[model samples]
Target: MRLSGGNGDERSAGAAQGRTEAPAAAIAVTDLVKAYGPVRAVDGISFSVPRGAIVGLLGGNGAGKTTTIAMIMGLTLPTTGTARVLGSDMARERHRALHRINFQSPYVEMPLRLTIRQNLTVFGQLYGVRPLRERIDELAASLDLTALLDRPSGKLSAGQKTRVALAKALINAPDVLLLDEPTASLDPDTADWVRTRLEVYRRERGAAILLASHNMPEVERLCDDVIMMRAGRIVDRGAPADLISRYGRDNMEDVFLDVARGRGQGAVT
Candidate 1:
């Protein structure tokens, strides 16, 4: 089932809520649309990540979450509308704008032959990070990757690799961070550590984060706001608590279940 309306306007309004003195939202999608063959991959979806806020993108598979993130990252073009990264039109100035953003996805592979430290150094240089060694040390320490730095990225355990992936994403000191299933392979303890590091980074740097994950607990624990999508369209969105309250549930998982099952009011069934 598909939602009737899109989230374009809702996202624009949210983006405009950022403080007047701050850089426009770190990320903004306005009336964004993308289609493939007969399916609308992203059906006029929209949202904004205010500086320093952690926003969760929650949905079942094939719901356009990945496609949306790809568009925001300039990895794919939108069929209609626009997306801006750090206040610049992505379509017009993708390279200049993308430099201010970095992404980490568990599904993406880092170079297998490169040692963890070597991989990070390569990416750091590619992003033009100055004092690359010092920055690598800092990220390694924070993500608990100092011990694994010398191990080949492909040889590390799932949790260790996840940490390295996060460190790579932070190498650029980006204003916007896109995380897709960041903690998917992590155990509870390691996942908690990763979450703590991310929280600290956002608090200290005021970076805007867009996280796409199915982990309801992670979303509730980290995100200040949540956008719920289904069948390639946004059906409901709000603060996690607000979504739970609105849906008459005690937790976000329940709310997610309700929406996913097509039970929410005005939602397509």
Candidate 2:
């Protein structure tokens, strides 16, 4: 089925404006920093994700990925610098843009006693989605959650919860999506299905996606560009194939390894 919205006319208008009137990046970070006491979780990093693009954020544990995502989502205040989403400063004006963005992560949980349908209803209402029941039904069917809609959210299996999280994220047909390990806990086939749905969403909405994942193959498959983070800093970034060639590696996995171990051109420091 077609997604909730489309940006075709916006794209046409942008094209008509020519090179001098390029659209603003859907997500932009400039010298962004977040610190806790003496610890810097993210340090002076900058990047942009254009509309209709999927950009992967890759890093190991304690590498600042979660903190960075939090700051971008306006859940955490940055120590310095800026994060802008759709032309609004996330720190000071996130409310203006929050309705147009959504985030998903397997780690977030819904109330144990709430049914999946109930949870979706609450979120849909919060987002002011018109015809809420129809939107919920659409997402349930698309995410294969129709059979489990009345199940208590906490009782669902890990894979089921992941799908529910995705449905929640898409309830408002967000223009910007932030995903953390989007396919986690699912079987290979299910994971592939989820990726395909994400691709469709991006294409249908001209959305910008910022994905954080340790799955090298998934990153290689879904991302237009990959940003590598290590110790609160970006050590490398490029298209998967370009990074592979630059590091003389056969695939993204090896390239990731090289960076993580400080072995190649864009080695960790």
Candidate 3:
């Protein structure tokens, strides 16, 4: 059974409370829709990420995950509906949200010629992060980029690039962080390290994070909630453990399997 309709069931508490009173959520997307001529890439999707929560956006290829991310980041215009980051309308008032929001994606590579320090410094300046030099040093040390600070970004290995990308993402210490395939190509140890660092960041900073990933175990480990999308619509959403119990599955991977394969009817509560 395909999951249809907007996010009445899947919306966070702040979203459920109504936009007028939209409670200081980290991100809020309401009745959001996107289309490409004959294809509806994202169809009436709505969801939110509350303060300090890590929410996963999970789906297979062409499930509209990319488009959705693009919308929130203000890279693409939505066909209709609003997406607010830190209460600023993304489509029209992006400047207000831009400073407090950052995205990290391996697919979106940085300037190869720039050194690790150079790349991060550029982004930090763009966000107007105060005491920029101090912030870069702080991130370099925290993300283990101290040794690579002088190395050209393009000269680094894939895993090294991933780590640098993460450092760039956190340069501004954004209140809202969007990550796509964060651990996609990392080995087991590095991926685990990245996950642990993310957990620590959220706990200490109370930041809201939207993680778009295919790694099921990673999702189960870090996310406080999971929003499953299929064919551009949210099909199932709840805490990872709740979804597992509801679907009678042993883990998030199995629950994801059931939703992706369209196993049952009326998936939303």
Candidate 4:
């Protein structure tokens, strides 16, 4: 019982109302596809993130989550289809929207020789943040990096570096945030603290967030909607509770297992 398409009339009607009557989606992807030689990294898939909403992108390795996110960020070009952020086509006009968006990934590292302050300052300057010193100070205080500001980025522990990466991402106060494995290396207590801070940041700023993560509990706690991908296509999507109930599962972990292992196909809707 795979999901079907939506109504055309409703979509047309919504389009007719225009931007003023209905705000534009913060992130919009339509039939997005990406390929490498004979392999299709991301098959045709479409979805959107409304303003202030947090959407989770879930998939096992080789399921296309990273490629999809890269296309959305304009770091990788799609073989076909389109990704638009803030009404700007990512392939042709990402620069227009780049200043309003930010991304954080623990897999992406900062310069090792630069101090935490230096790294923040460099990113802030790139984003054209006004009063850059004050902004850096504010983030250091908020993320508890004040004491580590002068330390070389390479010298910090994994948890400390994760915090600094988050600070760098928020330096511009971006309206669209893309995060990949934001809490990958932190201990349980530190991970919880980081999750709490993210909630506060989203609530206070009304930012649209697209999160790619492997942590089922974290997704269940933070996401308003979840999109599950397998073999480069979206197989199922729904709210966390709705998906759990639909699959007759006790928790999202079970639901994820069903999706990942191709189990319970008759119940997947």
lDDT of each: 0.82, 0.84, 0.84, 0.84
Better of 2 and 3 by TM-score: 3
Instruction: Give a tens-digit lDDT track for model 4, residues 123-160.
Output: 99999999999999999999999999999999999889
Sequence-dependent TM-score of model 1 = 0.91
User: Distance from true position, residue 261, model 4, in Å?
Assistant: 1.1
lDDT score of model 4? 0.84
- Summarize candidate 3's per-residue lDDT along 1-269 as a digit string, tens digits: 11112453334565454444544667788888898898989988887788888989999888988889999988889998888899888999999888888889766899999999889888887888889889988888988888999999999988889889899888888889999999998999999999999999999999998999999999999998877889998887778887888888899888877788998532554
Candidate number with greatest lDDT: 4
Given candidate 1, what's the lDDT at residue 58? Answer: 87
TM-score between model 4 and native: 0.91
Model 4 Cα shift for residue 138 (angstroms): 0.7
Pairs that clash in candidate 2: none
Once superposed on the true structure, which residue ranges of model 3 sit more than 4 Å away at CA? 1-22, 264-266
Per-candidate TM equals 0.91, 0.90, 0.92, 0.91
Off by more than 4 A, model 4: 1-22, 265-269
Candidate 4, backbone clash total: 0
TM-score of 3: 0.92
What is candidate 2's lDDT per residue for 38-94, written digit by digit as tens? 998988887777788898999888889989898899888999978889989999999
